[model samples]
Target chain A: MTESPRVVGRRTDVSGPGLAGAVTDLVADCAPEMDDVLVVPDCHYAFHPSTGMVTNPDVVEALVEALASTTDVTLALPDSQWVEDAPSMLGYDALADRTGVETLALGEADTVERTVRIDDERHTVTVPKPLDEQAVVAVPTLRADPDLAAAMVTVAEAATGSRERSDVVAASAVVDPEFVLLDGTYTFTGAPHKGRFLVAGTDAPAVDRAVAPVAGLKPKAVDYLRPFGVGREAIEGLHAEDLAAELPHEQTDPNGGEQPAVMGAGYRLYAKMTGDLVPPQFSGGSDD
Target chain B: MSDLRVGLLGAGNIGTVHLQSTRGIDGASVVAAADVVPDNRARAEKQGVPRTYEDYTDLLAEEDLDAAIVALPPFLHAEATVAAAEAGCHVFVEKPFARTVEEGQRMLDAAEANDVSLGVDHTIRYQPEVQTLKEQYDAGRIGHVPLASIARINNGPFAAPPARQPVSGWMLDPDATGGGALMDLGVHLFDVLEHFFGELTVEYAHVDASMDLPYEDSALVVVSTEAGTQATVSAGFFQWETPPEITGYFRLEGVADTLRSEDHLPKQFMAHAAKSALENVSKRARGQEPAYFKPTYYYQAHYRALKDFLDAVAAGEEPPVNGAAGLRMVEHVQTAYEMAEGTRAAANAGANVEVTDD
Candidate 1:
């Protein structure tokens, strides 16, 4: 019998103050003794922090400082050859200057090819050098689709260059960070929302399971989280169900916030019957 | 006049709209279409466009077309427009009409040499709110408007939430699209701004990219007309907008009062869609083709602009929004670009001077 992974939680007004203090307290029990800490931020694309599509750069800044209390911190970055220079675009370089953290590209960083087999397939995932040797602190935004703050959770699996179910599972097994922080500052349900909450835990999958329901995502719907086992304990005053009740649920599918074509048609017909124009997006020829 | 034979050049998203819209209008019809993508060409064929081609030049040469809609990428705008003009066809080109003033002029010169009508699809001014704003301002209800501001920001070139169309790479490339948000969105704004305030002079401009793109994704351009009406235009692709709540804020301040686009916009879309759809149903019953996306004023604006251009072609007259008009807006965009470059150079020089002082 395997012991259950530990999951913890924290809540704060993302707008006010003590964000860095909150981060320090939430991650207190997870990781601090390690010499080099690799902080992975949700930066698949350079979406502005205010939109909440990407992880709040401020939160990343705070987490880096907290990690630096004991030792050196390096923010993880994907290679420019693969995707956009997300670190530079998201102003992580500036964040590094302020927090005194170094940014290293995962592809360029020293890596050992580790073969991880999940179910019927095997993948050789290339993880950052520091993670290959030491403890890891990863933060992901809760998108309405999944932290239900998750938007395909591409930031974690971007280095692998595959965005499907198996690829994410493969990477998680290899990197298995000691601490995971879910950024719920701005959540997207059917719309862009100011979702002000933070979650933390040593087990990445356990942390996500506890946080996912708060963002309107069912834990069972996520195939990847099933491997981590069910038990979750909130380290602080944070309840996923209580928060889930407050959010709008126009897009709460565990498969990500993808609305089918038929939904668009039905919505269009509804707007037509009700004597209203469907949103400008459906008509196309909007901007650019 | 007999049906004006129209050839749609580049049957992508908008091309299909044109093909479908052509069926609604009586005096003009899309006879053939061209697109490099097989899916787009097949879509045109499905829309009942008689012939489809892999290249637009083929569509221009083989068919006896009276007019051609140049909906190809901005890089190919000059070449495609020149070919259509030289082929004795009136040309209706899409936005960013040309990459630069030189290219815009070249297309205009070709049209002049060929003696064919050249129209630009500047559709914003046709939106119901915009039309209302123009009428009220012209009627002097606003009383000597001295200042105006407009912003067109959305998740452009990329999808936000309700993802439908995958972004075309050319739209993001500065060289291919001529420019970024300013060229793609600002050109349309400039055309409409000129319509309100005749002949604007570039006052100031600042262009920056938030995303990791070679070109600017956000821009603020300020201009002043001979009448002393100064307008500030904010255009960006950085914004994350949930549809039904897009940020297209346009406002005008005058001595008497203020006017806003939001005030004139259709309220509670559900009710408006019902009425609009019913009207379209009545039109279809009488052999009049039902308007597509009738409730969406933006799409209807496209339909109106295309219809107006076809009317001009059928009547053998210059389009209401012609090639020279397109050229002037292109020049305005170039002037703004030059001003932004100059501003950046001066700021750098100032920093260097401070460094020398130290």
Candidate 2:
């Protein structure tokens, strides 16, 4: 196998008929050898896709359908430290129940502790037994982490092993997923920006490297992704350069909490003077 | 001086808002907070609450406070309020008062038996823009009002951006939340309409469930008051766009002209604040009690409601929005629900019948 895994990229529609096809292509390119696959997707918090905080359920549905064509795929979410009801709280349990796709709450799953070495340091971590599967697919949405280029490694870490932020890279390595699928349909760099693309490869780091530019980050700058050797190229379907050109965009906060005081005051004053309802951004549905 | 000490129950989504709203309010201080979730308790601590409890009953038993804010799920509202009342603490509960009218009555009775004030946070009527429209309507700015309408819509419970606070799963559970939009937002509309036009009779109501969800996600109701004023109210959980795109419309059509809540809203919030601040200063210089709530009325309706309740407590008077008002809103919602059930039953009955060409 190549040190820099062969990465394949394709356009995906979140709601269109093309999702199954794209997801199928990704599974075929990444985990063709495996029969039973454990798929892990980013689901840290109960955040909607519009906010770019968590993965969209549509992406997971497409993946599950695609994998069902050739493999016995079980959707998995590891119950980590922060949330107790991870499966229900993140909404994957409901999706699984709705679609009849068997889901494993990895938090409740039998866990085995193991020692792994990363960057010349040894660490002990607990990962679900499914991480030992011959084919484990690490599927994560494209979003910029304050510390990492993309949240793929962190998602793997969240589902498999340690909660310590620094141990994320080590946990991803320990999980040793055989494939990685990047759900780039909507990437949240700062705010939700549209990429409408998906990519898959055997190398998690190389896949993260490919998606780094899409989320407006340089692969070299992200320290956590350094474990995956550099110089991997993302082979695009149409234009490889177009993906990089679409990146480096800023995500603006919609809540307007951190803005300069004068600007907020001016905005509010304008609304008041004009007898206009405070801007919609400042308005929310009245819930008693 | 933080005289009226208060404790909070259920540090979930709305509880966080209640906790935050207590800050800087005169004569009120949140002394302790309780939540079933440890994470929520931690969050309350972060908000500067000194003590935390896993069970609200424990907090009520231990904390020495004048009142408790019952921001728990609706299923727990009645029981929690009763506990607060028994503990000799006035209870300010989040709306939909209870799961059933009987439960609401029990809560009211508990507060009465204990001689503790019971208030519900029906803050929609306290919104500055809505108040402005109410003022105009009261002053006959739009002539005699015949027809009025109120609507509130949002993406059921989970959509684009999840609620900022940790939303417990109970929000979607019918047993926990009573019904859906009608139970959640309908009570507020009913209360506001009743505030303006007293004693509304639900002439017609229809409800729809967007998905196979357990509860009705939408409600539409037509009502008439004793004065023969007609009003239509609708609430739905299907509002996809929030904040920037307005999802609520409150309007009154009079004989001469129509008045809308939107018209009274300040176009620029910051500009309005500056103007209000200068006006307040002028009033203070003239040795008058300035519009203390002028700045907050624009955005923080909860603060205004809480301030009024706290002031009432300090004065040993009944809260402006008391338990009776809360019960009235619940009664209105129950009637709407009953009407919807009847409609559903009739429609199903029609659907099931076999037509014979005898």
User: What are the runs in model 1 whose C-alpha is more than 4 Å off?
Assistant: A1-29, A32-38, A61-75, A79-88, A92-136, A146-156, A159-167, A184-198, A216-223, A237-260, A263-288, B162-166, B208-213, B242-245, B287-293, B343-358
lDDT of 2 at B206: 88
lDDT of 1 at A106: 76
Where does candidate 2 chain B have its weakest 10-residue lDDT segment?
B159-168
Q: Which tens-of-lDDT digit does each residue in A43-135 have in candidate 1?
A: 765556676667788888888877787788888866433234546767777777777778777767676677777765676766556556766
Residue B40 CA displacement from its true place in model 1, Å: 0.7
lDDT of each: 0.73, 0.72
lDDT (10s digit) by residue, model 2, range B206-270 = 89864445677789999998656799999988655533334777998889888788777767655
Q: What is the DockQ for all candidates, taken in turn?
A: 0.19, 0.08
Q: Could you tell me the lDDT of residue A100 within candidate 1?
A: 75
DockQ of 2: 0.08
Residue B61 of model 2 has an lDDT of 87
